[model samples]
Target: MFDRLFFVLGETFTALRRNLGLAFAATGTVAASLYLLGGLFLAYSGISRYADGLSGRFEMRVFLKDGITVPQIKWTAEKIRSFEGVRQVNWIPRDKAWEKYSKENPEIARGLENPFPDSFKVILSDLKKGDEVSERIAKLPATDPDGGVQYLRDEQNLIAQAKDALKVLGGMVGGLLATIAAVLIFNAIRLTVLSRRIEIRIMKLVGASYATVYTPFLLEGAIQGALGGLVAAGLLALTHRTIGEALKSFSALSQLPSLPYNDLTLALSGAGAFYGVVCSAAALYRLQLRYR
Candidate 1:
């Protein structure tokens, strides 16, 4: 049994070497694809924590009209924050709003005067009392003195926007890259099957079982996939250590924790291995029909 395993492994290596160019090509594709996917996964994991925090932190937004006094806004915020279930209140001055807007839309911000209004973000201990809290805020004389108080109807929109942004980016570019990688792997296996038709036919004639005939090829694919995944994982680790650290310094991004190294590596490696096995089995099945 040991000898057969060794023989199969040796043959797998031999096959890889024989098709060294295609093997390397497929490996590179797999590495790039897996790296992109793994990076997305880790990024989403980190961002989800931030998302949860943001969701918890911004249950309500109270927008003040233009020309509202800073003192008045602060007083109003304090009054609302003192209401039942209210935990925290933050004042967003027009300048701060302008700064945030410029950061988000630099092109559109050019030469534009700060027309943004003052606002307050309210976080509550019990979100179910949001309506009651809003009504209490409206009664405060310091809030929206010139007009009726404008309350944000849905605070969940911010979290929803954050989630949608990530999805849009992933679906467009990531989907394309993954498709390219899959096609590259599929072609590599197809080429291998074509190259080994005579050897496979000989084995079949010699009464080799299906597993005996195809096991080496299957393992070859798996080995390549695993190697590619490992390479991607290494790059991911480097990125997290360097660039990810820098991103954490920003106040908005500071909430995201660093990616867990070992878990991400294992996940990527497993995904890569599964990708290889499925593609190899498909290729082999096609060849088997042809040869039979």
Candidate 2:
């Protein structure tokens, strides 16, 4: 049994070697397909992660009512921290806020003469609860001293809208890539079937079982797919490294983390090989039936 298996493998290898040029061409095509698909997946993963990080930093800045004392500000911050969804409350002093603004926009800093209002920067466990937190903060007595705080959850709707828009855009991009991959693989396998029509017919005429003749072509397809996957993975890794180095020079991009090379490679390779084998089997089956 082992010897028979070896013989089948040997035959497949021989056939592949005999058509070295075609095999190389097919491998290149597979590699190119994999590279594009892998790149898209990697970008999707990276962007999704960055968006999550941004979401985690999404906090509500509650401006205090004018003329509030430091003790009242501290009391208000404590109250905010006690809210159900509140994870943390950071009291941004007027001076610190001014400093932050100055650092962020030097031109605006130079013109600023009036001090900005003090605020309680509330970080919530779930951003969706921004409205609830805002309502509670607004009811504080500091807004009227007697009773009537008027804080607004200004960033909540904007954050929710951005997240929804990004989700839709990501899905559309992924779907488009998937469609392109399907079309490319279909054409590749169709060409492979057409090119092997006569060879498959003679095997059927010799009374070969369907499995016996079809398995080798299926195996070849798998091998081709694996080759493509490896090449694509390697290219992706190289591209990622190159891009990361270039991005490091830019202060804004320096903080953004690139995808881990190993994980991305494994995912791309696995998906590429699976696509190859399935397309190969379908192509051979249809071609063999037509020839018979």
Best by TM-score: 1
Cα displacement (Å) at residue 28, model 1: 1.5
Expressed as tens digits, the lDDT of each residue in 63-123 for candidate 2 is 7777889999888888888898778888878788898889988897897664777777677
RMSD value for candidate 1: 10.0
Q: Supply the TM-score for candidate 2.
A: 0.63
Q: Number of the top candidate by lDDT?
A: 1
TM-score of each: 0.66, 0.63
Off by over 4 Å in 2: 14-30, 55-58, 66-87, 90-118, 124-202, 205-207, 255-258, 288-292
Model 1, TM vs. native: 0.66
Alpha-carbon local distance difference test for all models: 0.74, 0.68
Candidate 1 wrongly placed segments (more than 4 Å): 56-159, 245-256, 289-291
Q: Compose the digit string of candidate 1's lDDT tens values, residues 166-276.
A: 677677667787677667667777777678778777877887766767888788778778878888999998887888678768857563366676887787787787888
